[model samples]
Target chain A: MRWKHSDYTGWGRVHRASGELARPERAAALSELTKDETAPAIGMRRSYGDACLNDNGRAIDMSRLDRVLEFDPDSGVIHVEAGAQIGHLLKTFAPKSWLPPVLPGTGFATVGGCIAMDVHGKNHHGAGSFGQHVTEITLVTPKGEQIVTPKKHPELFKATIGGLGQTGPILSARFPLLKAKGDVMVVTERRVADWESFIGLLDTSEATYSVGWIDATARGAALGRGILEEAETGGGLVKPAKRGKKIPLNAPGFALAPPVVRAFNATYWRRVPDRGRTSVKPIDDFFFPLDKIHDWNKLYGKNGFHQFQCVVPLSSVDALRAILEKIANSGLASPLAVLKRMGPGRGGYMSFPMEGYTLAVDFPNKARAEQVIRELENMTVAADGRVYLAKDALASAANIRAMYPEHDKWLSAVTKADPDRAYETDLTRRLKLRDPA
Target chain B: MTPTWIILGATSTIARAFARLVAERGENLLLAGRDMAELNRTAADCINHGAPSAEAIAFDARDMASFAPILDKATATEGAINVAVFVGSMPTQDEIDGDPALIAGTITDSFTGPAQFLTLLAPLMEDRGKGAVVGVGSVAGDRGRLGNYVYGASKAGFHTYLSGLRNRLGRSGVHVVTVKPGTVDTAMTWGMDGLPFLAQPDKIASDIMRAVDKKKNVIYTPFIWWPVMTVIKSIPEAIFKKLKI
Candidate 1:
């Protein structure tokens, strides 16, 4: 394929970037692609922002680099191709009690890219992020190929985990797999008519999985009414896994706006609560309800859509409420707004977590939508929580570093390993993120 | 088997350029065609050019059923076809002068065969979720001109199929690209009467590869054609029916 350094994945509202599109089949190919280039690597083209973009450089399409090399069912660890999709692994190995340690919603994403992006999920509040589960990564460093784990290269490991592909082109990874109890979960649905109910639910059960919210203005007189779904992987086989094999089909374009989503969310919430507090959901329903539609992202339409996800400290839940009220007051067609909780930030220098609240809102990113987001980001900073790098469409680099606090140490490790700055990506270039040294 | 790309149409100037482009980057190159010697020579040339791995797998994209076994065997030897580029095709306009039966057969070979192979082969890429299928089309398909309209129609149909596949396979992480070259200088266009501008196969291949990387749905090789074809395709038949474009 043509090696282009391009980045148009996120923000048609923003400037689209570019990258190198080199295909690497094996180790030698991987090394060659990673050869002292000023570009970084790109996978599955899912990043909503410039993370996958490296200006005037290159991006090795690691999707083809996938190869499930080995598996230890007992140990629940897998040696796989850097470009392998998590969904594929779940189908083939998850049944046998093996899965990628970290899985993002874009199941088609490459494992290596996931680690590079350090994706997190609903369970992120509990498990931190995908990188947290990564035991080791095979790096095609400019120096040479080295199998680096935490112990092998502690500094580089941390940096690479959240370094956003600046450290090196991740060739493959050896990750610990979890024994999946089918793609099923025990979910409890509760309607939060206002901010109080929302916080009340959060204070109660510390579920392994959680997420939900509604733009009450979109829901008519039900200001701030929303459903909060909490799911837990309770031990024990529930039912035989349907193990659906049908590939996701394309869906018709249906806009989920404040009005439409509020109606749907209201209906959905009513059904859930009526059915009782406890219910069973397919893993897809619980984890990635949107994954079923192949190009569901396009539903946002030609202008494209952007999700602004940020974590706000517990003390700042009031700030989040103020922000929601502000968004509601604006009277824009916001169909989707999510609220979740974050725990401790283990070590990701740019980690977006705190013992606080996280809110992710999906907006059709038209022109000037960024300005609105920046206003919210200002509020987040004021609240002492930060925007998630993974889902952020726009967050100033200074803001990111300021929020994470470990920015300096993170860059030190990156600069040390990638001395030539040969691994800059769109995300790095956009925020002007660089080695502090 | 660690995964290798076995290009079936290695002799076409377009195919050769793609091989050279990929080989230049240090990947394993395996060329296959009717001309075994040319295939081998190209394989050696690819290796010399710096491909990390290179080999020749003799097969044809025209013969549909035979391809599965050959592809299965080759991927068995090398891993799987991460990106398969179909650059082999019969000359355009030949269908105009040729018999209807012959035209249908050629069209099947050119269109249905590749489509079948793609549908069959898609499962593997889906299993992998990272495979991409790049098919070469022509801007002639933008509108049915007097010169190469039949061929253009087939390309258009093929592109439509590609759109469906792209949509169907996106979640599986596989991508399909439709490369519509505005005009290209390949053996098929050697002595054609009048042509204003024609892109070099290598240059066009370069554009095709980039579109593939970007996972773009449809790409105009030179980028200029993006607008040119838009205007051309948008031309009203009522106004244009009076005069040829």
Candidate 2:
């Protein structure tokens, strides 16, 4: 394997890493590369932080190794390479009435990334996290390749999930796919007046997939006002998606400034009538709404942005409201803010999901915004909640350990799997996740 | 009838992408390469994508024995049998300068070996009177200069061989496309500096598919390379030899 000197950044582009990267195009190559080299494996770099980074070190780029190895149409179980993107699976199988059981906000997230993050989807209330559906995984460590299943090696399975690629490099995985009604989605968009109504709507939503888009710029009476979009798989013929659009270049800093964001949010909120509206869309349009515009992160400008996502218990909804209120007052939030209800479903020791409400908001990387995110992290911990590691670019090490009580277990498992600290990434080191509690 | 594609040097990134494209179109694939493990993975990937049948066969440009299995695999399938040649070797100019013996291996891997194999397979394609052969040559072959003239000469030989094959095959209703690609982002040019018009492997793969569909005899990928190479070729030998590009 040839190592290329590459400077890479995560999706948010907030943090950067310069390293030597070896991109293996096949599983055999990956196995051979891992046998001697000690490096973390990264997929797509969809995580908004350094979880995918290794500064001044060696790392493996797993994107080229993406491939679907096997699929059972009847059983709806597919075995895919770790680098395979979930979007590819949806595009291939949605027409066949099967889809990944869980999908993150972006279709570009690789299967390996989804596993490493143990990502949840809009249907977290129904399907749990991505790893819950994974039947088995082939993890390639410096020692050798080990195939672990949920039943065969539950502890290692749990550790590898949301383990941030520390357990080992994931080679391939077998996971059950969900049965879709059709290739299109019947989506209902309703306007929520405030935080109460948004939470009420989410709490009462019966749809298989539900998510709320919050107008983080709104304050006082209008605080938390946004649209609740609920969707269900429906059958019908629609024109296939047009060629995806590109963002072209990074916008100026003023593009997502307070006034522009407020105006955009107001117009976006009124897109649906007070009486509510329903429409049919291709599955991708509803699931990965931002994906139509490729590299939308460039909208945040060159410095990049930070996404602060946290989940608080159901009883702590009021604390969550206070956090949103703080964000509203700051006037630093961007147009992309989301709120969702999660069931008590998780697959890993360090998994982020809980039986609570999860709020995700983006802010342009600036001093005030960084301060607000730190304060928000404090409030989240006070509410006995945890933040999503995939979207966090800023969080103190102590705060992270306090948030994830099972961190020690995950740490022990990772240490055992990679005793030489072969797979430590920027996030793990920053959070002191590899060190004993 | 389903079209069957035989891919040479299937372990390369561009060849893998090309095989996947043909696989997605519901064609059959026979991946020929030196590494069986890598080839098998790609074959499985193609099969899973949509290929009616996908199999991996051993192939080594330096070994004559490896060529017959590929030919047999192509003949085993019915209907139009398309073949794409993505075989070549590029040892750095400095390495070649140090070891003169490297020249023969380079010629065999890039020009003579594939030319010989295709010469044997040409009769079968003629008898069938259908199919296409995509011979991937490089824009470096346009003119031998300071950087990598040894590899350039080998590709130049392959280009001439492809032109003659195209002339011969056109009479039998078989198409031959000689694809001259600029610096593509592959293992070969992974960390190379000063690469102009660097193209992705998938983009090159799609370009080859489009060229084959259009039955174009000779084309340059990214399209810009045609003009760029034209200008480079037009430079006078007196000055071109002095300036290192």
Candidate 3:
């Protein structure tokens, strides 16, 4: 197989790498490539950081090998190649009253990416992380093709999920599908007046899917003000969605300026009536709202942006508030900000979920914003919270070690799987995850 | 009546995408290819995607013995039997230059072998009095160039054969779509440099589906290839030979 010399970046575009990449379309081809030259496998590059990048080295692009291997309607179990997109599965199976057990904010996240990060969804509080539903995984290492399951190789399975492709290149995975009523979502949107109401609404909500869009720019009395959305799968016929529009090019520097973002957030928060409103939408609209506008990241311009996502424990709400206050006063926050409540359901040693409230806020890749993000990370550590590796382009190795208590276990397992450090990616090297302090 | 598509080279990226599209429409499938294991995996995928029934059968372009079993199975299926030929081989120009004997194998895989199998299957479609045959050719066939001329020539021959086949089958209610994709991002063109407007395999498959739906005689995928190929074909041979593109 021939490798193409190319430059690639994660969804955040804050970090980039120039490397030789090979995209194999068949399982056999993938095996051969990995055997010849051990390298990390990448899919969709949806992780908003350097986790998927390997600078000055070789990597394998797994997107071309996407295919469904098996499905049993009786048991609602399906096997799929690692590169298959979550959205594609939802699109194909939703009409048949089936859906993936867990879906991240973006449906474009590939199965491999979901497993590597052990991603969560709005329904995480109820459904757990993506890896919890996985029955088995086919990993292609330099050694050979190894089929490991939760039962057959529990240690390896845990290490592989949230292991960030250090164990091997995930070729395929089998997971149980969640049954759904239909392909549309019935969503209830309500206005959260302040931080207290926002957390209150999330605490009391019984819906299967819930998420909050926090306005990081809101200050003082309106701090933490946002829109809370709760949704459940429902059956109904609605008008077909118009073709989604695309962002043709990067917007000017002032497009996401502070004043404009503040005004936009206020308008968006009030779009629902004072009493709140309920509406029906196609499943994709609810699950991957930003996907409709392809390359919407360009809205931040060529410099790109950084997403700082951290989860703080329930008892540490004050620390979380302090972090938000820092962000609000910094004036570096962008329009894209999200807050969610997570349950104590995680699959792997390094999985990000915890019984806490998680906040993810995006900022333009400016020096001041990076400094603010560093301060937030420190506060999170002080609060005994953890920052998500999938969204971190800026975090110190010491801080990350403090965040993930199971670092020793993950490090040992990954070392045994890849002793040569062949699969180490940009994120791993920068954070020194594979080595002891 | 549901169409049962017999896809040659079932494991090819474009073929796999096409099978999914047909499966979503609740069609039946008989996937034929050399790699039975790979083909079987795709067959199962098609079934899960929504095909009424799907089975994998062994097929070898160089071996004629594999043809009869596939023909018999497709004939037994109770529906309009459509055939899509995505079977072709392209060795690098340098490799062919090194071993002239490789030329014969290339021609057999790209032209004579698929044409022979299609010739046998034509009668079944003619007897049924309704079906479609999608022959995947390439824009490289439009004019012989410095790179991959032998493979291009074979496709050119296949294109002519498809034209004649279309003329013969049109009266019998069978439609034929000749697809000439410029540069599809498949295993075949994975790392080739200087490829313009390289389209994904799914995009090319969707274009083929649209052409087959409209019963178009000939098409260039991405539509832009139509004008681009026109310019390439119209270029003066003497000057074109000196200019490396």
Per-residue lDDT over A198-243 for candidate 1, one digit per residue giving the tens place of the 0 to 100 score? 7777767588777766653543345566788888654445564454
TM-score of 2: 0.98
Residue B15 local lDDT, model 3? 97
Over B138-186, each residue of candidate 1 has an lDDT whose tens digit, in order, gives 7876788866666767777778878898888888887788888876765
Ten contiguous residues minimizing lDDT sum, candidate 1 chain A? A244-253
DockQ of 2: 0.66
Off by over 4 Å in 3: B238-242
Runs of candidate 2 exceeding 4 Å displacement: none
- Could you say which candidate leads in DockQ? 3
Segments in model 1 whose C-alpha atoms lie over 4 Å from true places: A1-7, A11-14, A18-20, A36-38, A216-223, A234-262, A275-277, A345-347, A435-437, B1-245
Against the hidden true structure, what lDDT does model 1 obtain?
0.67
Q: What share of the true interface contacts does each candidate keep?
A: 0.00, 0.61, 0.70
DockQ score for candidate 3: 0.78
First chain of model 2: TM-score?
0.99
lDDT of 1 at A356: 78
In the range A291-340, model 2's lDDT, one tens digit per residue, is 99999999999999999999999999999999999999998998999999
